[model samples]
Target: MRGIDVEVAPGEVFGFLGPNGAGKSSTMRMIACVSPRSEGTLQVLGMDPGVDGPRIRARIGVVPQQDNLDAELTVRQNLEIYGRYFGLSRAHVRAKAVELLEFAQLTERADDAVEPLSGGMKRRLTIARALVNDPELLLLDEPTTGLDPQARHLLWERLYRLKREGVTQIITTHYMDEAEQLCDRLVVMDGGVIVAEGSPAGLIERYSTREVLELRFTPESAPTAADLAHLAERVEQLPDRLLLYAADGEHVHREVARAGHRPLTALVRRSSLEDVFLRLTGRSLAE
Candidate 1:
């Protein structure tokens, strides 16, 4: 990782946005205290990770990119066993498991084996297990990667509750909409370095126009960036479409018509985090 520096305030939902090999996972590992940094200072929850790794880890909850729940164990047993590893008494672990099961909306499946549960159920259980110690800080790595929309919203609601209760969270995600919805403040990283940092709206306003006019045409008739440059503030040519960035998308669309440009389909939408991401990270796919 490069010389990355960031500060996440208490009770805030901070996000890390990047493509593959952007050092997000490496940074997360260091913050979780499972991997040591080679240089520079690192602090998590007011303690230096190098000196207080265990203490820091004890106070933070981590929901990894993938669920690692023991498939052989029942849903309730997964939570109870994890809490036991924290040295909690059996009675306390039992009570905590019950509360967490309800929080995860998995109480009905508490007695069922992990292997039989749906992907969403397993994800919820993993999150509940992470919270067994009632951590002050939570680190989530792609908390809702593969779940259906319904399950994604459910997880978002649960996270919102945690935020309301003043539990600080740091999340790393590839989904632009998810980051925009959950993050109060975020930083965009590329090639192991932070390139941009701000709230979702702030970044969009800074990096993009107020609206976007998307125009699609047949492959052979597609307009180049130079062809539509005067119709909008800027134009981005994609393999399938042309994006006209402007403060007024409808105005640009009308201008395009007046300029004798006909597209197969035209869509005018508000600028979003995805627009800002592609602008900052480039439209090319990251390996």
Candidate 2:
């Protein structure tokens, strides 16, 4: 994490994006005061983590990359126990547990043992637990890494609501769609360094065209970027297909046919965070 500089504003949903082992976790841990940085200035909530670790931690909630729930405890008890660890009154903790159960939509399963719950349910419970203290900042690491589509959307909605409540959040995700859906501002990290930073729309506008035209051709008949250079602003060639970046996708698609090149499959869609990442790192976000 050398030469990395980051500044997160209050009441903003800021994100760190990178592929596996790109040092996103290392940087996040430093900010969380769980790991010490060899050298850098890190201030969380206007306090230096190096000197005020305990105070900083008390005001923040963390939802880690994986769930670390007490499997033997009931859903409600899990929240209650964690709140007590923060020295909350037993009565307050118990009432907070009920509120969190409803917030997580787990009121019916309040008494269920943690081990039997599904992955998405466990993730939500973990988040609700983090909010037990009513911290000012929330740190979520890959919060939707392994959920089904419906579960992912539900989690996203909860996060959106949290945003409305003005809980400052810092999230780290490898998923471009997740970053786009949740981040107000984000930075792309590669090999422990920031390569790009901006709001999603701002980054896309700076790094990519408004739309992308995808053309998949047979292995033997794949056309070169040089052959279609005049049709779009830029061309990115992948193993299986070619990407044509242009403001007017329909016009570019039509130009492809007019140029006497026919692909096996063609798709035209708006540019995404994936495109911005690919442009910056010369690699797919999936890679």
Candidate 3:
């Protein structure tokens, strides 16, 4: 919403990493050509979204945060009908639906009404429907929200396959692990602004230490950031735990013990995208 500038490569996965209400969805809508921006110029897939909205939309696919499939229609019928909107031949749509059913792993349930399918099945069908026209760019808004672990991983694998097959993808998500796992390059957006941008590992290396020591204490015995400042490069105090950022977590843990600060539980782990976000935004991504 505020002077946002980003360019996604032809075959790479680009991501918008942010918490709720950080303008991720609004930005996605503009890129999808569904919502026009009030200011500044915009280009998607080499065309201005305002002047060439229809042409841009014809070559792009969008999977919204919610599944909007017709419950009365069968899984295959859903894809066929969506393909028809793009003016594809009926023969092409039929064959494409068959291929997409296999890709979504719903071939056996192709004839079943969408209302009876599992949540994962519905999510996959939504994504398959988005691909019915063989879009050059795919925009997914929180593609795996509210799904079980198995379903989430299955979707991740499908996305990986798409990347391998040269489909350019833009994903918006609050899940730091998902962003780290799926994105080749990403921008960390906060309050309608890009706070940082880089590959996940690059951002981690730039913004966070190599390791983090997490110490959880009883409410009465918790140490303040100032109390642990000498033990690590940086100390962050949270309601549940204290994060000690350091190049070596074990060394910081040993120092904390030497300093006579005992915690209920201590964990030494590698830094993550979450840590990078916390460092950049001064709050957790879930916030």
Please name the candidate that would achieve the greatest lDDT relative to the true structure. Answer: 1
lDDT of each: 0.93, 0.92, 0.93
Could you tell me the lDDT of residue 268 within candidate 2? 96
List model 1 lDDT by residue over 101-201, tens digit each.
Answer: 99999999999999989999999999999999999999999899999999999999999999999999999998999999899999999999999999999
**CA lDDT, candidate 1, residue 238:** 86
Decide which is better by TM-score, 2 or 3.
2
What are the per-model C-alpha RMSD values against the true structure? 1.0, 1.4, 1.6
Candidate 2 per-residue lDDT over residues 1-287, each given as its tens digit: 87778888888999999888788888888889899877879999999999999899988999999899999899999999999989999999999999999999999999999998999999999999999999889999999999999989999999999999999999999899999999999999988899999999999999999999999999888889989988899998888999999999999999899888889999999999989987887674444
For model 1, the stretches where C-alpha displacement exceeds 4 angstroms are: none
TM-score-better candidate, 1 vs 3: 1
Best by TM-score: 1
Worst ten in a row by lDDT for model 2: 278-287
- Shift in Å, residue 69, candidate 3: 0.6
Clashing pairs in 1: none
By TM-score rank, best first, the candidates go: 1, 2, 3
